[model samples]
Target: MTGHRLRHAVRRADLPAVAETRRLLRDHLRLWGVPAMVDTAELLTSELVTNALQHTTGGAVLVATLSPGPGPRLRVEVQDSVARRPRARVVALPEDHQGTSGRGLFLVETLADAWGVTAWDSGKVVWFELSDPRK
Candidate 1:
């Protein structure tokens, strides 16, 4: 498949942006013929976007790109105006799940095929990639 890219700018403190990003991701993955990726992709995307908006003082940017190859790979990135990197804490499972917070990066690390953070001069970009299993 040919490469396809989708980008969305998220405003600071815009909680609804989380859902918007998920919707955009779901639609694109389906259109790209990677429906199997919808659930995991949306969940992980939401985690990253929520982290960016919640932790940064400024807005964030969401970019989802589909790389062309025998097994198409989807890369989703959430860029924020903070240089600090995100860390995945060791959640105590059932107990930690009781809290109303934490566990974003933990979820990403557990689900994504590959994920990382890149620090830029102005901020950082947290991203993850999910490869099409059908391929």
Candidate 2:
């Protein structure tokens, strides 16, 4: 698939919209015979979108871009109007059932081949790219 792109914009109140975005990516990846990554992609998208919804105010724009080159990659961008850059807090790993926090970015880091943040004049976008299993 050359020049493939998928974009979605939804308010925080629209939770189903988020799930639909994930499903769209899952379907596209399935068509590309990368079904193995569907679940991970969906989960990652969910987390990113959820973070944006919880942290921002205006809305969230979830963009799924398929980049074809030497190797294919699925890129997801979640834009938010929040002023702060999405930062990952390093937390101590424990085996007990103590309260924990700030693991969303950690989960993204664990699953994404590459992940980072891009700051815009108005806000920022937290993005993650997963290698296309087909490639």
- Tens digits of per-residue lDDT, candidate 2, 6-100, equal 78887865766777778788888777656777888899898888778777766789888877775778888988885566455435455663555
lDDT (Cα, tens digit) per residue for candidate 1, span 1-135: 799999999999898878988998899999988998899999999998888888888888999999998889999998999646554434445753676677788788889999888887788899999998787
Best by TM-score: 1
lDDT agreement of model 1 with the native = 0.87
Top candidate, metric lDDT:
1
Per-residue lDDT for 122 in model 2? 76
Looking at candidate 2, what is the lDDT of residue 54? 72
Positional deviation of residue 97's Cα in model 2 after best superposition, in angstroms? 6.6
Instruction: List TM-score per model, in order.
Output: 0.89, 0.82
